[model samples]
Target: MGSFQIEGGHRLSGSIQPQGAKNEALQILCAVLLTSEKITINNIPDILDVNKLIRLLTNLGVKVEKTGKGSYTFKSDDLDLDYLHSEQFKIDGSGLRGSIMIVGPLLARFGKGYIPRPGGDKIGRRRLDTHFEGFIKLGAKFRYNKEDRFYGVEAPKDGLKGSYMLLEEASVTGTANIIMAAVLAKGTTTIYNAACEPYLQQLCQMLNSMGAKIGGVGSNLLTIEGVEELKGCEHRILPDMVEIGSWIGLAAMTRSEVTIKNVNWNMLGVIPNTFRKLGITIEQQGDDIHIPAHTNGYEVQSFIDGSIMNISDAPWPGFTPDLLSIMLVVATQARGSVLIHQKMFESRLFFVDKLIDMGAKIILCDPHRATVIGHDFKSTLKATTMSSPDIRAGISLLIAALSAKGTSVIHNIEQIDRGYENIDERLKAIGAKIERIA
Candidate 1:
């Protein structure tokens, strides 16, 4: 495992562009399997998980060509069907949770889809029940192999017939997988309680551009009229909202003046306002967000009722659970206290212990909540060694370390690399003293 040795107390000042949406890239890349023609996708993030999925596609004999730095053309005309059922595919497919999305498009085109138990951050129990239930509702037979620990979905002789499904919860990946499968099914499919995040909306728009009939864009209820076949089309992914939020938190923690360029501000629902509530100065300049240096120290804003502020995560248009850790870490330097409630994932708040050890006043109220008493830059954080628990926590720890008084070593950087594209180099561009050591 590699580690990042970061020297603290540097004010980063520059403009940086956020990478392409990792989640959207996963969805778009998997959508390539829905057609046999060449699909050109631009603004693909070159990260570990995305690259792993691309390699998986190549292993299945899809013709992949690199058009530019973050562009690719994928043609699935000669897929190796036998490889999908082999043992090797099971091992390869388990590397990332996003790999599970491949099943939808494959089942839509080939009548069969198989995937091993997916792997990702051990934040909490991520259930695949929603995905299987969606497929089952679409007239596909589902089965699980006890010994092999893999799931398989096979279409009936008549193929998939569209139906209405009200999802139990708005699971992003689950909604995406079902959407991919439903676009090619027979008749019409109505998905209520669908995730309307920008990434899913991008997926629906891309599929529609590829000759699929999907209505109700940017809303919870999606109506997809099943088409006989889908053709490939060109699509460009938007900036990663999670990464943009992380950069905002990083700029505040380091007391830096950094501008995030080319950010699609409209797609970022509550991210900008969430950080603004922490008393960080956010200015919108055209398509960019400028985070001015908080030299006077940031003060957390209280609720209108004079109660302690609460930052919580909900489905869409709410604060994302992925950035809760970043919010907690940023709150450590603010002037007031706030309640950080991580409702979605149980184990995510456990990383607050590491922040507390670095001189931040944080109380781990429970596995799902933490109360942060802002230090307000009165005491500089004392650097220490820590292990990254997950992707968001890793970046949060990096932010904390960058603002600390001494050097800190963060191990398990692979977790960070799985999501962020060239994070160290990007930080270096903004004058951060981070070194990657193997």
Candidate 2:
């Protein structure tokens, strides 16, 4: 496993342009199998997960070419038989929870698909019941092998027809899979409580251009009217909103003056105001966001009872559940006590023990909540080897290392690279000492 050796304590300063959204890229990449015509995607983030998906697509006999640095063109003139069942293919798909997203597109295109249990983060129980349940709504039969823990979905002979179903929750990838499958189904499909994050919206927009009529661009209720066929179209993905949030947290924790460029300002409705409560100063410059270094750390805002406040994670437009870990690290320097709650997953709060070792006064209340007491000693984290748990947790560990004292080595950097694009290269431009070692 590759590792990252990072020396900490120096403030991060520079202008960074976040690459395209990884969540968006993954869902969109699976959409390529929806059509055989040539489809081009620009501004794609060069990340591990996307590269893995590209290789998986190639294994399926899809033509994937790099036209430029961040541009990729995919065309499936002919798909290989028995590709998904190959050992290499199953192993690759099993590594990423996102790969399960391809099940819907594949089932739609080839009428049958096989997927082992997908793996991404160890953040508690991520259920595929939504994915399989969605498949059932599309008139497909599914069977789970208890031994292998794999799922296989196949449409009826006349091809699947759309229907009305309510998702248990707004599982992001689940919504994407159902949307892709319904796009090619024969009739109308209505999905309620669907996750309408920016990434899913982008997928819907891309499919719409390909002649899939999907109603509800950014809402919980989605009605996708299935069409006969879809033609390929070129699309440029929007900048990542999550990275923009991470930059906000990093600037507050490191007290660095940084301007993040090409941000989609309109999409960032509740994020800026939410971060401001913590005393992080954020200014919108057209489509960009500027974060100034604060000598005095952010303020911890409280509830109606005037108690110590915390920033928690939620679905889109609510404080993102993904950034709460990083925010907890930022709160350590602030003069207040707050609780970090992750409503989506149970295991996300497991890394706070490492922070506790670094001199931060934090109480692990349970799997969902952590009471972080700030205004502790201004100390440094001793160099340690840490393994990443998930994409967000991996980046959070990096943030803790960057803010810690001395040097830290992060093993299994592939987890961090799974989402962030050239993170070492980008952080180096600012002033952090981070090197990728084999």
Model 2 regions more than 4 Å off = 376-383
Worst 10 residues of 2 by lDDT: 375-384
TM-score between model 2 and native: 0.96
Task: Please write out the lDDT profile of model 1 over residues 1-438, one tens digit for every residue.
Answer: 999999999999999999999999999999999999989999999999999999999999999999999999999999998988887798789888999999999989999999999998989999999999999999999999989888999999899989999999999999999999999999999999999999999999999999999999889999999999988899999999999999999999999999999999899999989988989889999999999988998999999999999999999978889899999999999999999999999899888889889989998888999999998898989999999999999999999999999899999999999899999999999999999998
Cα lDDT of all candidates, in order?
0.94, 0.85
lDDT score, residue 234, model 2? 99
After TM-score superposition, the amount by which residue 204's alpha carbon in candidate 2 deviates from its true location, in angstroms, is 0.3
Q: In model 1, how large is the Cα lDDT of residue 26?
A: 90
Measured by lDDT, the strongest candidate is 1
1-438: candidate 2 lDDT, tens digit per residue: 889998877898889998998889999999998998999999999998889888888988999999998899999769984877778877888987788988898888889988888888778988888888998999999998889878899999999898999999888999999999999998899999999898899999999999899999899999988888889999989888878888887777777899999899987767888787777789989888999888766777788899767667777768778778878877777767888888888999898877777677889988999988876325555557787777787887788788778888888888888889999989999888999999
Using all chains and alpha carbons, the TM-scores for the candidates as numbered come to: 0.99, 0.96
